[model samples]
Target: MSTHKPLGRFLTAGAVAVAMLATAACSGSTEPSSEVTELTVILANSTFTENLPALAETYKAETGITVNVEAYGNEQLNDTLKVKLNAQSDEFDIFGYQVQDVMREFVRNGWLTDISDYVNNSGDWDWNDFQESARDAVQLDGKVYGVPVATERHIMYYRADLLKEAGIAVPTTIDELEAAAKALHNPDKGFYGIAMRGARVPLVTQYSSFLYSYGGDFQDEAGNSTINSEAAVQAYNTYGRLLHNYGPPGATNMGWVEASAIFAQGNAAFYLDADSQAYTFLDPQKSAVVDQVAYARFPAGPAGSHPYNIVFQTLGINSFSQKKDAAFDFIKWVLNKDNAKLLLGEHTLPVARSSAWQDSSATEKFPAGLVEIVRDTDSNYVGHDRPQLEAVARAREFVGGPAVTAIEGGDEAAVKAAAEQANTEFQALLDTEKR
Candidate 1:
């Protein structure tokens, strides 16, 4: 569980460059410089990518290096990296990836470099400064694989004006939340009570918080599927009931953009999704309820309030890259605490560094209520928003099938049967991985 260990007593000559980073860091020198003068970095089209061009320019000015930056859409990045890395092409020295989706698979395939020495030995990089949940996402079997760059968590978004008009308090428990949804629901007026992702694959991540708080998980202690556990059935029913009964008519087709739009357009009283959606809800260009939107922790369920605070994006060095030193240095420079502030303060994006959250720059930039919710959920948060599996997409599709049924107005018996069927398939997938 330790990310940092005393610099190993004995070191190979190949480790000299890595070991030197500690001494330079102790003196607070800018991250180590590499002789390599050019590097290519592939990144997803994310909010954070906007900061990189300027950073690359600054780094070039300081280090005489040329950074070639290429960006792709989410699906494009996943597909591109799969083929590029599988062929062991070193066209890119570094890459930004969706941590939850492919980190385990990449690690298994040895596509990512083990940067344990770089992360652990550097006082400047300060691995311990990262949130525990963020750190856990990049580690497997006590080895460091990548650095988490973006963080997000599920939270409740509500229309404060509507809640006040309805005379219902912000819910603290699942039952109270359901009651509030029921009381506020009014489809005739074209205003439903709740909104959330309902598309089968997309819903799996959001439902994970519900699943955990209901005392169920994708797998039990022994890596067996629990999709049909009593707690899981209860979670599926509650999530489905809210979206099916109190949500929009076509919620089965909605993902984040679609579902959150309902809340932003003033058609829903409450929404549960990533806290990142708060910015969208607050945007005057897009939101009809800009002034009325507010934030709260995910309501407690039978098990307690276990919301997901997960690493949404990560940076990894290509295992086959000839410029590993330059790649590591570039990672350290861009993901430094100083840069984290740029992401948090200027962009209002959630960051992995704890210090960035405490800075006044970041504090003044984010909504006070949203920051409070982060403080409350940060301590007791789940690490992964979906099942922790190598074949995560397939697992999500299989396990999430029941939630889709529940959302389509399936009865209890039908939902139970779907869960049983999904569990058998999910179990087979798990067993294959185990073998």
Candidate 2:
């Protein structure tokens, strides 16, 4: 989690659209009707949930549908959903989930509805408006299971004051980024060259862009592990060396919350992670480098700056829900173009709508520099951040072993051996799934 703060309680109709979408799942109506008067929704602890109550309030006023929201932490939400869906509970009509982490697992478990036919049949909801990657993120076996809520990518956060004071231009390539980090590194004075997730499990997603930019991937088309490939080894080497050489000590236990705090407190020169955390740095109350910070696209590596452009959050209807049509109606309304613009404009949330990206007025809330960077990176990005598997958590632990070794300052040979070991174990895991 990014340690993100929620929006204001009374934001407006746009903020509550999420609640409407979830509520849509529980109502047992063939079409829009007065019979479906209330809806129950479950959500992970997020910015969306912060506004959920007020959002549901607005929805109720507009459509007379009362939307009840239950917010839980990510782990708890997963566990709760599993328990409830296992009993085929219809307590929640719809819910929000991390697409990459749980979509495949949910689909396989028959926990989500295949809304493809109805979604495609709609005249107003232009499904094509979503990014190709976002659209694909919600699908399994050619069946659409959910609607994407937002698009996310890895972005670089840098100390603008430090770079300028040191007479260094913003780095454009990975090599230059290292050179700049080296120039600015002053750990003896309590400042370091860079910061990033270093803990083995959480590091995988941030490490993904490095893997891709070096022409490596977690797996190949044949579903075999590629984590120990020549390119992969090099990528692991670069990530490990940077953290070991420049990051804070005891970084092995640090996740985004800790690592990002280092940079936010003005203790690091560069930080690389999900763009969703940008707000943590931008909020003056939570940061020391508010004005000193600047945004950049992930610096290009050997292959290029191929950050993961992913649909991090998505809304899905309960497969067991009797009010399937009502749920679809809610989704259609919640994800409509107008509501997308409202989210982008008010909350600075990066949405899945390409048309929304073109709305300059809506994008102005983001830094001028960021708008350009996101626009360029959005067009050139890989679809998944971590290994795309049903067992994502386990896969992250496996693929990240070499990076952990690298971060601990292992020699190239040791790192390579770790990659080899991890790859073998990961392959075994994959093979089991095939059987």
* TM-score of each candidate structure, all chains considered together: 0.89, 0.88
What is residue 67's positional error in candidate 1, in angstroms?
Answer: 2.5
Predicted structure 2: clash tally = 3
Supply the global lDDT for candidate 2: 0.82
Q: Residue-wise lDDT of candidate 1 within 338-423, one digit each (tens)? A: 66776676666688888778777666868888988765546678888888788888999997889999999999998999999999
Off by over 4 Å in 2: 1-35, 61-64, 377-379
* lDDT digits (tens) for residues 1-435 of candidate 2: 222333233335654443344332232334344468767778887655665576566566777888788999999999999999999998788899988888888988889988887667665467888887778778877899898888788889999998989999999888998899999998899999999999999999999999998888999988899999998999999999999898888888999999999999999999999888887888988999999989999989899888888887788989887667766666677667766776677666688887777789878778787777666645568878888788888988899899999999999999999999999999988887788
Which lDDT values do the candidates have, in the order given?
Answer: 0.82, 0.82
Compared with the true structure, the alpha-carbon lDDT of candidate 1 equals 0.82
Over all chains combined, what TM-score does candidate 2 have? Answer: 0.88
Name the runs in model 1 displaced over 4 angstroms: 1-34
Query: Given candidate 2, what's the lDDT at residue 359?
Result: 82
